[model samples]
Target chain A: MRRRRLVAGLLLGLLLGSSQAFACASCGSGGDDPLILYPNEVDKIYVGVARATAFKNVDADGRFSTSGGPTVKDTLTLAYGHGFSPRAFVTGTLPWLRNSRQEATQTSLGDPSLAARYALVMASMAEPLIPQVQMLVGYKQSMTHSIHDSADLKTELDVFGTGFSEAKLGVDIWFGQLDWLAGAAFNLIKPLPHTYDGLRYEPGLASRSTLTAGYVFSTACKTTFGANLLARGSLRGDGVVQADSEQLNHSAFLTQDWLISPVESWRLSLSRQAAFGANKNTARSDGVSLAYLRSW
Target chain B: MQYLLRLSLCVFLCQACSTHSKADAPAVMPASTEGVASKNGTFFLKMDWTTGPKSAATSAATLSFYDANHHQAISVDSVAVVPWMTTMGHGTAMKDQKIVPVAGQVGHFTIDGIYLIMGGPWDIRVTATVNGSVDTATVAVTAP
Candidate 1:
């Protein structure tokens, strides 16, 4: 009888210690627990680092070979997500970047992004098999100068940001069974026109789409596979349109997520981008990223 | 929770304090005094700066062409100086700098308004029209 009482006391203690873990405010009970889109009541903070190396340049004709050596870029980011309501959240991210190729290397602070997301529909309440839909709006502000010396052959490599501020409108849909999940996200990115250093330039519109599929290995672990497509329009510099600047690229990626506790998780991703099928003026690269997130 | 927070803070601080080492971040390659031979080996090009490169600032440089033996100066019809960042694979803006032939000086040209734009290694590409043919040579320099 004493041993039974001791076990009961321990169970009660655990329940009291991690009440926020099992009870997400959005889902009254534990019914809407998806692998990737975990709607929780707590705020989240994330730190991530990514590295990408470009080994070849895709020419205008879509040929996947170039004469130069590899170029590597590293990015370290800190992000925060704040949930103001049960179905709405806002996020912000700041990044530091470094780029190196051959004998030249540079490091600088990159752009910061702010975004807000709202869940239009929750799948569990309406229909368990249906997908949850979320809408997002975001803006990325350029923090670096847009100036470049045209006489320097590699001037573009030294600059930090894309040289233009961009706005994003996007949507995400996620659906899953008990052990498998699928998701799709699409974002339209529009860069604003800004004049710098006596030159007026406006970048064209761009779009990114990603489709993801995941399998739950256990209650605490999951693995995901995804494909991404990015398309960009022509850029106009000083009232002159550069038609050859448009790009279309595709990449495939794999990721693994491990939930260490109710309030902490870790994720690792690997990706390979190829220059094929209408790709133009872009580099073929491989990338890897690791992230750690904590909630409170 | 307190321990986790402390751990996160420690990780961030350690990462932020780290920097690239010399082996990883190579030093700039200065231009060679021996000069670079053109692609066809018909002429050689040497670059000398009156005012060297400064980050985000304009500077000036001179280009002189020589024969294959690197001893005799050879004159060309026209010279165009293109400053390139080879790593980033783009050229600097022309700005107000135009390649001008030095008066009464054979095989010599001057370029002004040469902006490096950033602190890194840059390639100065010289394209000259010699004997109805284009001969190109490139020299590398670093901007402060």
Candidate 2:
């Protein structure tokens, strides 16, 4: 029996090489897509990877209420930013995570940030749509602090940075008039019991909002198209392991930005996030993103 | 949407059902508790003990953090020593599951070369941070 046909041909070539690893995707956007930095005024660097999925768990009525099923994450981001003057700017991030559900797979590092953005006004063309107001501040820490892998007890999926110590403020409003534009952003995340773990984790205060629309087609290899609508919520937190919590979702997305020269910029995205009408932890993901941007 | 793209193409054709060989698919080894775990009010961290952590081996410890009433002692910056394996929930990518800090030794810390590839009930967590106040303490050691 020729070694059982060579272990059945190596288990059929590792089961057909397992769908090419699904290109390992995940570029954070946790509450549902849209947020690949849109305050570009030069000085940027981005590297992306997004592959999200959540749909598997027949939930033939077993238990664990509040809607259930879905899990698969892959996030590899290394965003950067700099713009000392001209309305201020400063950013940083370091992420590397790989997640899987039901089968159990966990890779670490994600949830490392330092941000600053400012530009309260600027938009001409006889004021295509003025009101310029963009402000952002960030600080998120807790590297290698489990949420799903290290699991001390807290599983609903989506894990990366939540070891606590956050303080971020946001606002973005751009209603362009010069190349067709429309934007709205609102962010606020606060959870700073200032760890020493004397028991303090109020996953409270989490808000993310987005509403964007873009258009720029200047032929000759220049095209930018966009559309987004996102929402996420979490207020009144408490999870230093009293069960760990936070949930509420909404989603929508569509994008395409390509201009492969003079510094390079390429983006292609598609999203569909779920968990409408209050979802405690039950996930619902669908994502695909590709980015490669560099600027001077 | 086309049945969610055929259920993500049947979950990537069920990812090649690996039959074990990532260095034996980690699972087994854990048990250690030299005692030492603290988290006082307003910040006063403590871990004070642990050595030769099990569940695959390599573990060590000694700790103390401060900021209690501002007497001062909170300079930790960063530290991570997560082991965790709660009845096979999954964890321990093994690479020694590192965590180091000592240089001057102010509450010493070293969980270098960790590899608790699984076993049972292990919550080694030892997150420490200063200058923005951050803290975590866990040493419920156990493995076998």
Candidate 3:
């Protein structure tokens, strides 16, 4: 009798706890919502785990290396709605790893972001072409503590600064079973005056554009395969002069997904980036992951 | 005495009436083989069931395949069922029901050859046991 009562109480508590956490009264956006990094794409919710490793070399001989060295990151993304409803839903990516690189003297947890996306145009059934437009805005705050004894390297590098704010505008087009999506994003690093000679220094902003093609082969099995090409470039600046300055940045990635079950999936992805023009550098990374998802 | 006699007659008549109704009633429809399709050298066995009005009581269906020459059966452990609604535009629900290793009263099973790596003529058996009543059917499929 006692054990039965205890079990019942525990089950009741769990039920109530989840209901409270996932339920919202007025539909005001909450933290539990899915995060959207890509804009104007398919109408599907993705909840899965992913781990990625990035390797980068500033100079050919490894003068400066920004390899996160097998840093594990998981993502939860949600995309919903058929066509142009002003209200498209999104929110949820929290980075759990502290990014460390050989170039940086000290290491700490990198900035994570929270963002929301809204669709501008909806797909129409009459027309064969379905073009979707959307925007995403996110902010990442830096929380790394300085390792330098004094504010000595403050002017040299913007250490212990408030990180970056980003915005992306994108469009997605669908033709039959194939989906094509492209987007451009801008990242602005906030000026840090306290660390940089009390002179607010704004690092060159980073800009990126992406093109993705995906196909739904078996709708019943919910299996999808796609390839994505991402091009990232840094805006050139007139003031900064370092040993090796970056002028162009480019990267491409390919991804495949198998829906093992409705609530579970396995994914594989690979990417390579090359830096050229005024800047000469190259990097490559590959990763595979499996995740289980449950929705209320 | 007359009242007792009428009550006995009513009981006998009820038994006789139920016997005929039971005879006319449908025998639990046996499970059937619908289609066998192959993709990338692996065969997919599709099974259909006549799930009378009682959907909950129907536990689960099993598919078993046996080798022709050896007469030995090998169970395909990774059988999955994807539920699709006939309603247009309705999203399909896919579920994975891997066979649990357990002993059962009915040893017979249903098997499809599409999931086999090397395919040829194979004996297929399907069993749908519900509430102690076991209904089974078998078919042979040639995989190319």
Candidate 4:
């Protein structure tokens, strides 16, 4: 009886933690952002810096083509170890994304996120089909920013706070020169008041699925190119469907690295993606970017 | 080493030529106000090609519609291409294609029997073979 109670308590704790982990409210479609979906099977501490420029026509219907502005975004990330391990070191990434539509309205600010990654299953060396799996949990806070009063005209115009708190579960497989990665994650976004003033809002759930392939160019250098198709569905609010949409975000990227005496290495990468097939007020952003990564 | 060099040279040349061909192709003109129509509403699809030394005396083409999601809707297979000539010796050919509703017409090409569920952005992917040169054009359409 005691053993049963202990098992029940542990299972309950895991459920609560997982629920909290996957809750993130923000766009899941990739645009100019670096692949947050990391590669599988490599063990090392990596630090990367990147910037993205996005031009979006937020109103998918072309009704308000000029309503939303172009956005310039930047991000930095640090990760440690690889595969599924009991504990892994991780930190860093504060994104600053800014939007400027018509000259009359514009806004910008920093989105700060901190998190840790833990591996749940280590791929067996003997079994070729099994994949390495891991769970990532993190918290992100969007710094407040000043916006033009004119931007307050619509709820969609003013995006505030670091959008959502997120929990992620991912799996990766490495076979020969090709590395395949697949993951599913859910984000529970906290509700915020509509910018239109006095309008109550309910943040809905956002989910994503990703697949990536990477190829090794040399012993120390590798380049990866892959496409990730994401779907963001079911936005219910005020007893009605407010913002529900879907988009296919696909990208290709290449990374090069040079080992600096074994302990440390420097890496550079470039990537591009487009948001095609979107419904509702889905924002379409596409751009090319470069990144610098260093390992200690 | 000589054979390897020749193979590499051939690959490089093909890549360069492919890029050039795409760049040289005429851009698809956006449908004018006189031509735009509501989604699912009937609209005439017109295709024109200029005859050249590479132009085939006899050729065939296909017109396919993809939804706003870029998924193919109606694939009108084997649209007969009738040659129409311009007065200035600049050979021109045109075709008025029709959309026929049928099962197994929507979604990706592989899925067995799915039709276009609804309206959105639809892309018309045209594949035409003239003379010996085959070309494809992806045109955008919004279904009301």
Best-performing candidate as measured by lDDT:
1
Under CAPRI classification, how is model 3 graded?
A: incorrect
Over all chains combined, what TM-score does candidate 2 have?
0.26
DockQ of 3: 0.00
Better of 2 and 3 by DockQ: 2
Candidate 3 residue-wise lDDT, A1-296, digit = tens: 99999998676544332222221111111111232322222333444444445544333332333321223333333323232233455554443332333344332343444555554554343542544444445454445433211232221122332333343333333233223322223333232222322322233444443344444444212222233333333222233322222324444445444544332334454544442222233334444444333332
Ranking of all predicted structures according to DockQ, beginning with the best and ending with the worst: 1, 2, 4, 3
Model 4, residue A3: distance off in Å is 56
True contacts kept of 2: 0.00
Fraction of native Cα contacts kept in each candidate? Answer: 0.05, 0.00, 0.00, 0.00
Question: Candidate 3 on B62-108: residue-level lDDT in tens?
Answer: 44332222323323433333221111001111122234433331223
Error of 3 at B47 (Å): 81
Give the least accurate 10-residue stretch of model 1 chain A, judged by summed lDDT.
Answer: A25-34
Model 1 ranges with Cα > 4 A deviation: A1-37, A65-70, A102-104, A145-157, B1-90, B93-144
User: By descending lDDT, how would the candidates be arranged?
Assistant: 1, 2, 4, 3
Superposing all C-alpha atoms, what RMSD in Å does each candidate have to the true structure? Answer: 21.6, 27.8, 30.4, 24.1
Give each prediction's DockQ, rounded to 2 decimals: 0.04, 0.02, 0.00, 0.01
Question: Who is ahead in TM-score, 2 or 4?
Answer: 4
| Better candidate by DockQ, 2 or 4 | 2
TM-score of candidate 3 on Cα atoms, chains taken together = 0.40
Q: In angstroms, give how far residue B56 of model 2 lies from its true place.
A: 11
Give candidate 3 regions above 4 Å deviation: A1-34, A37-56, A60-86, A98-109, A145-200, A220-244, A260-266, A275-284, A287-294, B1-144
* Model 2, C-alpha of A149: deviation from truth (Å): 9.1
Best by TM-score: 1
